[model samples]
Target chain A: MKDKELLKLVKQAKNYDSKAFGLLYEQFVSKVYNYIYYRTGSFIEAEDLTAQTFLKAFDAIGKFDGQKASFPTWLIRIANNLTIDYFRLKGRRPEVPIEYACENCDDCNLEETVLINAMSDRVKGLISGLTDEQQQVMILKFNLHFTNNEIAKAMGKTEGSIKSLQHRALSKIRKILEEEDG
Target chain B: MDNKLENALENCITLIRNREEGIDDCLARYPNLRKSLEPLLRAALAVDEVLPEISPSMEFKKSFGAKLDAMVEDKRKKFVLPRKASRKRIPPCVSAAATKCFNNGVCNCLYLCCLRCGNDGCIRQQSSRQLTLPGKESS
Candidate 1:
């Protein structure tokens, strides 16, 4: 939808229009789900978090200020915060479930699924070793395809800091891969 | 790593992703940092490859939509209905006139006329006259 139309729908949704809210949900559900999936590395948790994010958004849409953030940015921030809270509640970092990853690969053949799962596990393991900020930057950059400035806005960081974070993350991942190969 | 090299590597990555520059151009631009930058770029590519796009299942979408509908319905019941009911409620005198008009089969026009006049006393007098009529007592 165009920005003008989306803004109008947002206004209607703020008035508790269920149909307008449903349209916004349809537009954002997949992006929000994929973001949480990458962060939590678990489909079940991602699904739960995505639901919570939207429910929370629906409850808070009245207070949402368009000047403060676009709808997607605001929604993604909620998802990111919920994922953090999930980690705090569990008292553990997210773990890549290789079996779950393999089972969810509907588009890949058996051989391709196995290889992709292996690579995913390894990469997730490597990323999980980084600081939370670094991991988030990498995921936003590579997985979600956000530009540095967009990631900065979503993360509440400067674009310069995002560039440094991406650089450091890549450098650390390279070191880990080298050590593993040796 | 030196800050310059780090900045250069980041710029190279951006350029390569944007198709503005190739690996050879990047390597030639920073020959002294080639070895370090190359591995980092390769790791970046590997990370990109490993990040798969997983979508929500059909069951999830269906259930979530149902759940959202229920929540919205509940919210409407809690917040919207009361406000609308309050806004549409007719005053007592107007309601009496409305009842009399209903019996005469002219309520729609009477109600619209009352709304246009915006006079409670007018509606009250109108209703009192109707009430005095013997046959209209039921109204």
Candidate 2:
């Protein structure tokens, strides 16, 4: 949706318009679900967290300000917070088994599927080694395609900090991959 | 870890992401850190390439939407307008706007008061107030 139209919807949603809120939900549900899925690595947990994120956003929509951060940015922030809370409550990050992650991709040849799953699993394993902040930055940057500015807003950090985090995270991942290759 | 090297690495990643330039250009720009940063950038790029995008299952999506609608309905019941106030017919737009506000989990009385005021400014003020409430402490 255009910024103007989204703002209008947000305004209406703020006034308690369920239909307008549903429109916002329709617009962002996939993105939010994808983001949570990447973070939690569990389809079931991602579904639950994604639902919680929107419910929280619904309850708090009256407070969203488009000027400070775009709607998706704000929503991602909420998703991130909920993911963190889930991790805290669970006391560990759940790894999605390669088989589980690859269950839906029936189009690929068997060998291609195996190769892709292996690479994906390797990449995710390496990423799991980074600090929480670094992992968050990498996922938001590479997976979600958030810009440094938007990420900074979502993560509540300065753009410079985000740049540094991304650099350090990438550097760490590179080192791990190099060691495996060697 | 060096500040200069970090800046060069960040710039290289940005350039690579944008497909603006090749690694040779980045290496030339930061000759001192090339050997260390080069492999890292390549590894980062490789990992970036392999990250998968997952979609929620259809059943989950349908169920979630239904669940959310039910929650909204339950909240609507909790904040129903009083009988005396409901007797005085409200403009469709105003009532719609007020209903929206109530659905947002705003206090029932506040929205009711705004509706009772029956002017654009009251609604606008209430909306502004609602916008600021959650953002003040957190943002």
Candidate 3:
């Protein structure tokens, strides 16, 4: 939806308009889920985190100032915080669940599934080895296609730092992929 | 040269993302940078290819939708600002009339209808004299 339309819906949602809230949920739920899925790496946990993110958003939408952040960025920030909290509480990072990765594997046969899962594991593992900020920069850049300035704002870093992080992350991943191939 | 490479990679990658140029062509545009940019570009593509943009299952969507509906309804129910309703005050004139009727044994019809009274405000009879007067309430 257009920004103006989204703002109108947000205004309505702030007023407890259920229909408007539902529209907003429909529009953003998947993006939010995908973001959390990457951060948490489990469908179940991602779903749970996604639900909490929306609930928290619902509770606090009244205080959301559109001038400060776009709704998508705001939602991602919430999901990111919740994912950090989940890790902090669990006291351990999650191993990628091949099962969830293969859940929507485009109906591939078993062999194709294995091949794809292997590459997915490699990519995820390489990314997981990066520092938290680097991983976030990579994910926001590659997965969400956010520009450097937007990612900087979301990650609370300067655009210069974001560019540095992205460059370093890409170089690291490329080095890993090259070594593994060799 | 690191800053230069960052800007070049960003520009070429943005071109790829926008489909304005192919990767090979973009890399070709920067021959000196190709060696630096090729592996990263290839690695980025590998990651993007396998990291599929997946959505929640229909089952999950249905369940979350139900949950969100309940939440919106809950907020709808709770959104009431609960204005303190101002009560309608009984008019002072009517109350004064009633109070006078309680205090005197006279009818309140004059105050009620702007007619004469027996010189007092109460629920009693009047004499057989029609004189313009104010009930105790008006007095």
Interface RMSD values, listed in order for every candidate: 3.1, 3.6, 3.1
Model 1 whole-model lDDT (C-alpha atoms): 0.79
After superposition, candidate 1 runs with Cα above 4 Å error: A95-99, A102-118, A180-182, B1-38, B90-139
Q: Candidate 2, residues B1-40: lDDT per residue as tens digits?
A: 5668666766887897789988788788888888877887
- Native interface contact recovery, all models: 0.57, 0.43, 0.57
Worst 10 residues of 1 chain B by lDDT: B130-139
- What tens-digit string does per-residue lDDT give for candidate 1 at B38-138? 88878887777777655677678878988897788789878998999986887899989978878777855676665667568888566556447676565
Full-model lDDT for every candidate: 0.79, 0.76, 0.76
Residues B28-97 of candidate 3 have per-residue lDDT tens digits of: 9889888887887887776666565667766777788888888888867765433222223567798889
Per residue, candidate 2 scores C-alpha lDDT tens digits across A1-182 of: 79899999999777666777778888889889877876776667788999999999988987999989999999999999998899889887644333344445554345644655666676567777778788778778777777888999999999889878877777777778768889
Candidate 3 docking band: acceptable
In terms of lDDT, the best-performing candidate is 1
Worst 10 residues of 2 chain B by lDDT: B75-84
TM-score of 2: 0.68
- Flag regions of model 3 displaced more than 4 Å: A94-119, B1-3, B81-139
Lowest-scoring 10 consecutive residues by lDDT in candidate 2 chain A?
A: A94-103
**Model 3, residue B10: displacement in angstroms?**
2.3
